[model samples]
Target: MKKAISLLGWIGVIFTIIALVLTLLTTYHFTYVKYFNDYYTLQWSIFGTMMIWAANMMVFRTNFKNIVYPITCVIIACATMFFMYMKVY
Candidate 1:
């Protein structure tokens, strides 16, 4: 049986996807004039999504013991962020 993800989780997934895409695009091709790179932005977006899911869990579920979801989110976010950081430049 598959666990159902909430609306906020879906949103977080979407945000992560967009962040990765933007980072890839900015890194390979056209660089935005104002910013040096998009990795920081990617990292922040991932972190933001993780935060959003965390808040959702706290307000709705409030189960600290059942932390698999939130921790997974944070790890994926931070890992992707760091991957971008290491892969880029």
Candidate 2:
């Protein structure tokens, strides 16, 4: 159970990296494949959910001094979502 949660958190990190790459590619009109129109939105949603889940798990499972990781996850999630909403390049 702990490993699964940790896996999800790492997966979320990888997804976030993918999202950043995709956004950068899109910005330069360098799309490799025609993604669905709502792909970015959907990706953002999943990214947010996974990261938040990881953060929740961390908050409940870890010591108070180790709170930084979860907080960082949440901040990254929110920042990415905000960029998605604003359609920033």
Candidate 3:
């Protein structure tokens, strides 16, 4: 279970990076990557949030020493979602 949680967290990080890059490219008119848009980025962001949430739940339950990372993950996920929600740059 712990391993699974860790895997989810890593996957979340990857998805978050992908989403961020995609968003930035689109926003700045760097359209080398085609056939992608806000909708796909939104999906990536949502998946990232879900994965981080699951990982955080398990990590919190385990009483780990390094709680800061999970907390940071949750904060980043929430902020990303909020930015997407408000359509803010």
Please give the range of 10 consecutive residues that has the lowest summed lDDT in model 2: 33-42
Lowest summed lDDT across 10 adjacent residues in model 3 is found at 35-44
lDDT of 1: 0.66
Give per-residue CA lDDT, model 2, range 1-40, as digits (tens): 6667666766766766766677667656777535523357
TM-score against native, each model: 0.52, 0.55, 0.52
Clashes of 2: 0
lDDT (Cα atoms) of all candidates against the true structure: 0.66, 0.64, 0.65
lDDT per residue for candidate 3 within 1-89, as digits (tens), equals 76776677677667767777777687678774553445556555664766566576655665665666666656766776777777753
- Residue 85 local lDDT, model 1: 67
List candidate 1 stretches off by more than 4 Å.
1-12, 30-36, 62-64, 71-89
Number of the predicted model whose TM-score against the real structure is largest: 2
Best by lDDT: 1
**Per-residue lDDT tens digits of candidate 1, residues 1-89?**
01233576677779778777767777777654334255676676677777677656655655667677767766776776677768743
Ranking by lDDT: 1, 3, 2
